[model samples]
Target: MSNDGHPMKGHRFVAWLIAAGIIAASPALADTPTGAARELATKTCAVLAARVDEIPGSGPVFLRSYDSSFGQGPTAEPALANAAFTYDNALAAIALTACGHRAHAQRIGEALLSAVNLDRAGTKGRLRNTYRAGAQTQRPIPPMGWWDVVASRWFEDPYQVGTATGNVAWAALALLTLSEVTGKTRFRDGAAVLAEWTVQHTRDGQGPDGFTGGVHGYDDAPQVLTWKSTEHNTDLVAVFDWLDRAGAPGDWSHQAKAARAFLDAVWDEASGHFFVGTTPDGVTVNRAVSSLDVQLWPLLLHGALERWQRSLTYAEGAHAVDGGFDFNDDRDGLWVEGTAQAALAFRAVGRATDADRLLAEVAKELSPSGYIWATRQPSISTGLAIGPSSATDDFRYYRRPHLGATAWAAMAALSWNPFTGQRLQPVRVRTTGSK
Candidate 1:
């Protein structure tokens, strides 16, 4: 049975193959650079398409974000067995779009639309960070959870049910991407709803002046997170700008400017890198840590590289681990998702060789199960907490086969920019030694 309790049919694989453009009549896979990239992209899309095929009768269906590792058999990792993270699903939607799988992309898009219209505990326009991973058969859609036989109660992870600014912006980006690809107004309109919720709830005017971290629980009155994130603001800069370009009303240009201003404020002139963001005070810069995505994602903004290219240097210096990239400055291990993100950022800046180097690292992470590993180590510390109740910095990525990492790898292989839906042109290949 699917996550929504619907029985699935096995005949969908052929249709999925046709949608993925992998019919038998297709040209033979080549050995050159472009051919190699296409091969990687085709394999990655096949992984995603197989996930989409697991659900039936869906206006909105979600694919689980992570699968158990190679030796874990067919059972999902218990912690995230039913969790379809909005951010991961959004990345999958954009990756499918980039790979020319419109029908599959539309299924995830419909799921995002369903989330936008059906928050079980909040106002209609907002989305939780995650939902149950399957077809939406229940009204107001269900958040992810499982029965705890030991505790004799249903257990829900608080972080999964909370709203995060970055996650919601990613959802909007996915919707807008679908709108651009399919020319559908409903997708665009759904993105507009997300934009409105973000502006109304998370907008902050404190020190740096951008969106906050969003709510942090599953209650009707969830705890409002006062912390501001450079990463979150970076996501909104792309989102608000896209909305403005789509002729979405309601001062979207000014909103974009506000988000951009926040990014500008967080730039550290001395280190030439962005600070992680503000503390809970929302007035003081949180210099306690560094994040890889915070440094690279902003570079994808239109014309941002021309102004903030130094951030790339900073990332190389601080986050590079072995041959790949890590999640934070400690550089303890390879973070496959961050490595893929760095590849796309490099490609965007005309560093095709640099992009290729990172993609090679990403390719090493491919698992026998067709999904990508989340990290090189058996477990890697992020130096962060998983939820408000966590006692310490207990958050970590294990050696799981991750859907999000695979989607990002596919994007990097296709040279597709998730934020803008435009392909980055590859220039002359120049080897830039070690990171």
Candidate 2:
């Protein structure tokens, strides 16, 4: 028997070991859609369609950024101006697709490709606040000598800032979605790189985890800027999940192992919670104690193990706290928007009753722009009003209403998730020859 004819048994043993590892690892969850879910999606899709840009090479979105005077003005809607970051575009892309606005999402993908062409803007793009005094903002993707700037970041560039994990992961997801839509290998390859980097860096800072912080294992060692991230750990897990499921080969096994390890370390089995950021001593509950009804990160990342968030933090004056669920941080209670997002997450894991109640609140007060933002509620904290690294604008962060979070909340409300709570399908409201 020739030795070269037979494959090594040791190699087969390694393959089995890897397979066992993946099987033992946690799996990312999926959601199905229904009536109200479809309606919310349908309305949101209509809004995106009305507002999207129909350009040639760059499928740029046409809208405006929020102005303080008008927290979300006509000009504040997404426009060509805010299309640079991969993360924003990624979430927007997936939400649009979920809402059935596939073309609009594709345009987002195209615009991302075109952004690579802008030679002047570097990692910061063409933002007014960035690049002081005539500095060229756009640099070639993977600027010649710099080490961490990968071809994907240079090419896709999810968020305007390099360190934003949400941008990196979400944008990568959007690209993966695009690859699914367009049947292209390029999108898949680029998305894989970004996803790998996200998982690697989130735990140990292997691939420039984007945020310029000394963020260590569950530690808030804010390195670059003091602007903290409550969602990076929870949200970036989404990247690991999508890439893992997508069969992204290179370094995926390692990335998955690292992410699993990091998540395991942060989960507090004792308190039945997950620490958003570690206190200096590691056991103190300085960061956050529990999950919010509105916060979907816990649900999305961990699939809501009954033991972790089976408990609820309820609002005052409620009747025995019937709708209690996931906790809200920053002292922000269960407002309509937060409730709606909570409903969305619940729907993801077969909690339809909760989803209906949450979506109902949004529908009752849904604004003309297809969203809900209450200005008078003193009990609740506005979600999106806090600017991205706009710590300098602390007054605005505290005083103004949550604008960005409102948009996201609205998006979640309108999404169609059959797996949410118990799959409350959208009521089919058709307008056929009705005046």
Candidate 3:
């Protein structure tokens, strides 16, 4: 649990220096390369800091995933109110580490630990997709809910309370990052618990030979999801690899290999892109749609340049929108988070100019409230459903100030890779005849 290097020194010191005006401001705010990144990172930190738990020594806290002003009006998505998504919180934790706020980041990590140890269903190794935002109460942890005056009962969104493999992986990644930076065994142990649950519950030898979507619906009768996602598996590749290196008690190296196998299977060498994932059967490849994240995330892998370098070019040609990128290949409008992912991918590939251009576009997404918008349009579709009960592709992103988007922008600006807890390194080239 000893720190190998001071993660708190470099970026953290620089950010503090910037705040104190010790360094001259970069030219043309949000225009120059470093200026755009600095602007994004500074604004993101300001917004996130405002949401920190005010009380000293308070239990872990979850930052509300969106601004309160979002879920209003007749067309309101009320379920979002006070819902702290695990994915966003995880991203925020990693972003906080990059921004030099390890204490604040650890609070969020403590919240994830709460989720792990005190799940509402009393499950030992499970976490919901979302939890009630703010300071933690006693165990079993509370699920997100609000009073429904019309129904005269407390209502909770099924999707919010459910566990998704991708979200869980993200939480583990966040914990692993905190553990790495803080050298805290508890955070690493918590991540291992989540990874154990994933390997036990979701791993599949079905068509794709990877992990499944995870459980959905209510606790009493949770539906086991069978669909396998390239994105989710991509996440697992990193998680399992980290666990393997940590020498956790499991076949994590094998788990990582299986996840990589899935990634390799779904890779379309002819098309130069990855398929979305498998269908509900878990065996049949679901090539009906293409997603932006699936294309960009894999490029963060160590040997990505050797195997999937073309994916970067393929993503740009297909998903680029107004200098940003979209959630899906339809390219309906800009998805801020995905655009940030693309920026990091560009950075990973040593295309600094490409990264700078994408970042400049991302800088424009800064909302007046200091958070970034989820999307450029009023709404944008992802061609996916909210849950198993949904009949249509109702999943969409609104033009709301989003914690996830802001966190991603901060990571991109700081050149940090959420998966690795290190700055994004150029994709490694394998010498000929190398393993």
Top lDDT: which candidate number? Answer: 3
Residue pairs of candidate 1 with colliding backbone atoms: none
Task: List, residue by residue over 187-237, the lDDT tens digit for candidate 1.
Answer: 988998999999999999878778998988768557888989899999999
The estimated TM-scores of all candidates read 0.89, 0.60, 0.90
Cα lDDT of model 3 by residue, 1-435, tens digit: 002113243346446546755233222123324467776666566556555634356569888888766422222456777788999999999988777777778899998987887676767779999887888866877877788889899887888888999999999999999989988878889999999899999999977789999999887788999999999999999998888787777888888988988998898989899998999999999988889999988888655645576887888888888878889888999898999999898898789888888887887776555567788777888999988999999898887778999899888988888878887778675533211
Residue 180 in model 3: shift from native, Å?
A: 0.4
Name the Cα RMSD for model 2.
18.2
Off by over 4 Å in 1: 1-36, 69-78, 426-435
Q: Provide the lDDT at 387 for model 1.
A: 65
List candidate 2 stretches off by more than 4 Å: 1-38, 53-58, 62-87, 113-162, 196-230, 279-295, 302-306, 309-337, 371-435
Descending-TM-score candidate ranking: 3, 1, 2
Give the candidates in order of lDDT, highest first: 3, 1, 2
Query: Which candidate would rank higher by lDDT, 2 or 3?
Result: 3
